[model samples]
Target chain A: MSQVNWRTINVDALDPDSALNFDMSTLTPAVTPVSASEVQGLAGQIRQLLRGGDHEGALRGALESVPYGADEKGKEIHLHTVIEILQSIRQSEMSPLLSRIYQSEGGSELLDVLMKYLYKGMSHTTPTGGAKQMAPQATGFSQIHPLRTGDGGGQAMSVFLSWHEKLVEIAGPGSIVRVMCDRRTV
Target chain B: MAQPEIHHLFHRPIADHSFSSDRQTLAVARDNLIEIYGKSGQKFALQDELRGHDKTVTGVDIAPNSGRIVTCSQDRNAYVWEPSSSGWKPTLVLLRINRAATCVRWCPSESKFAVGSGARVIAVCYFEEENDWWVSKHLKKPIRSTITSVAWHPNSVLLAAGSTDGHARVFSSFIKGVDERPAPSVWGERLPFNTVCGEYLNSTAGWVHGCEFSPSGDALAFVSHDSSITVVYPTGPDMEPKAVLSVATQLLPFMGLIWTSENEIIAAGYDCAAYRLRGDEQGWQLAGSVESAGRPGMDSHREESALNMFKQMDLKGKVQDDTKLKTVHQNTITTIRSYAGSPERVRQFSTSGVDGRVVIWSV
Candidate 1:
């Protein structure tokens, strides 16, 4: 009934300012449905969980999120937040993030869960396999290099690329694709 | 607590949506078609479809005073629809460009509209009475990449465009004939059509997702892909700005935002819920979200007993399901606009997203 002032007060958050290295533990992650405040707040912890070989736990950390509502739309937002995390992995922190997940045991299953959610997230409203068709159709996405197990040859991305291959298998060979925001690289 | 009214339009992604001045009609860009919905008693019913664009329709907007709808699509075309006695008539605007048109909006005066495009230009379109058709002039000097979003000042002459080049710029779109030469504000006096008033960028050089001019047109706020929102207060056109404040948030990046007042802004995007940010030139801070999370209908709903938990596990193979977001929108919120309000204060706002749901929230 009452209005709360939601303006976040983080001084010097702009460019060419003194960086604020605030503590992450200073704010706790809410177990209840996540609002905007809890999204990137757990990036470090989720990465740590992935490195610890807790694939399911890391997957839970991502997909195990709860929305603020019981409605179907609320459910979609929850899954959307999960997709945001996956996109961050694919776009920004691919090597470090994916290597941790791929090196861990049952890491392929985590990829499968991601593939499933990718389908669910895009297919929530439409019958299209969403990510199923996109993954294979989008040629711009990075290709899965020949994977090596021992000594982890070449870039740490070898592990990452292997998981992407496994994702293609789960979502069907032709379904792996990428959707980008409004930008023109070509 | 208040319940947000949600209209589930269809299955495919809703790139953008708009409402007529009377709030009796709605138009949404589904794929290549603009589906218009007419309000019955309480729900919106399908009325007609505008089929023209060959590719996906990206944005749709209706002028409040003129009652005309402007639509832009990935097919690199923009159309203006005028309501006629029989139905809506579509007139093609000459947006001489190559890339996709990303976003479009009518100026407050209803005399013109601007379309942001992937061709790294903002096409300012208006009617050329001599030619009896709409004509556009390109704003093409400083932009390096695609223009993601564009907003108009209350005066309807100054335009704010956010681009993939990681800059939000204020340009004076003063057309010699279409606009009136009025009092000069902090932006500048003797403003030319392409005068670059001010330019600001985010901390990490993130793509500027949304840009908006405050009610008084004295301040500008923009959200970037780095999960940060920055507000700029320009003292003059050439002088050093009075203040450029940025709020780095822990949330996901925001897609679009709107000014409810000079001091309050409602922004929603990948987070799916609309958040309230209130502040002034002195300072700014996020108040919270407009919607409550995870707790609505807590007591009235069926109790989650041990039996319910087991039943969920048996059916879905999971105890805690992440299929639903606690927010009203299911996916990324593509646009947020003031539903009912004057330039100074907004009473309600609406949001449409990838989940294909349009939600109106009262403030």
Candidate 2:
């Protein structure tokens, strides 16, 4: 089984701009910009990897791409990704966008990857760590800044920043950075 | 698809009629008197006026196998009445309650019956052969809040009570000497839901107005102050909530809720409208809407207008109190219940409101 070419999986190819159009106000413990993009890209890659017959690699890729951030949008994206993956696996469908991959023998493998990553990410990034702890005092703001109490508290923050850099590294800093900067106002 | 044929066995202008277990007789509480009507809608002629209840009787229930009838009144007394050759008369009266009695129902198969009072306490009375009428077990705790409605589990072991505090509590009776366990007392355990299941907060401040357990005993349907209905399952030891369905802005508080089947629910509200909801739908569909024809105030208003036209003919000072008449239909709805015999039939049910006339609807 061939591994997914992470570099070729551009942020534009995944259509991050359109995907972010949904109202993110209701998202709990907001998500970070980089983390959101990575999640979007991972969704696309998982679709391609499943279509390409690299089930093991797709699973491994999903496991590696964990959501890390306190932002409500980020947490919502994480939850949506997990739900999407589970639903796809349950219905034996490929990711939402790439229908061509759905017809291939690699579809099952792609589903496996989405499932692996979703459960792994969920356990690692349970909502209890962040805004949940400060929820009483922060009121509505707690959803935007989920603060982890213990040691590894900085892990999600660093992962979020790195995830954004990876998108800029793969899909031209000019296009990706401009989009990320615009999302702050949205 | 063909519509189910509904047979209307009887129709009367009686205001508030409650059914007995056999569905053969109905006990109608009107004005200050309680009348029993046969299935054919004929007055049983056994008219017994319960005088001790200084106010209108709000609810009545009949025991399953026994001939005893329990009636609750605004006067704050739950009276047990038994039928004799002369007429139906109140034999025992339990007094000194905090609020008016709102609902009363017999335990499915037990010798006991339950009463929900305005005070939020549910009193369980067990029948004793030696005492003649039922007596209160007086379990250490009265149900914790002001109960608006009470339903007995079909099998008779559990009682589901809905309160004014927006919570539903399930009380179960345990065997007294089945094991080394202590004898089961009157008041059972209580369970409260963390959040009301089907309510959509319009202004973030609302309480549950009504709730009923389904006939199958598998689900509990509740209506919230926000005009939304919630269906919950009370099967497991944990009492897990399975689904929450909200009906937006259409209905308001003080509505009636009843199950048409295991999955379908029907509700009516103060808007003079009724709606039916299936499990798969996002909200309730308007089933029917009707204005009461005999609204007491409207009748009195018409009478006053007619009297003025006659140039105040010489007669006794029988002018009705306009304020008292106006208070009759404060809420559009007066009373509601499932069709007497068939619990699953959806097309027909019974209701009475400010009109003071009971109307039965089909389709």
Which candidate has the top score in DockQ? 1
> What range of 10 consecutive residues in model 2 chain B has the weakest lDDT sum?
B195-204
lDDT tens digits, residue span B1-363, model 2? 222122222333233556566656767766555666565453233334545567777777666577788887777777888777776667665544667777777776656677777654566666555756556543213233467677766655566666544455555643232112222222223322111222212111224556777776656666655445666653345443444444333234445677777667667656544456666323333343333323334454545676574544445344444334332233355456775445655555665555444445542
Count backbone overlaps in model 2: 17
* CAPRI docking class of candidate 2: incorrect
TM-score for candidate 1, residues paired by index: 0.67
- Residue-by-residue lDDT tens digits, candidate 1, B1-363: 557778998877999999998899999999999999999997999999999999999999999888899999999999999889988899999999889999999988889999999977899999999999999999987776789999998888999999876789999888889899857999998788888999887544567899999999999999987667899999997998999988655466788898888899888888888888999988878788888644467443345789988999999998867677767788999888888978689998889999999888887
Error of 2 at B152 (Å): 1.8
For model 2, what is the alpha-carbon lDDT of residue B216?
A: 64
Best model per TM-score: 1
True contacts kept of each: 0.00, 0.00
Clashes of each: 29, 17
Model 2 segments beyond 4 Å from truth? A1-186, B1-16, B20-25, B37-48, B64-67, B93-98, B138-144, B173-205, B280-331, B345-347
Question: lDDT for each of the candidates?
Answer: 0.73, 0.49
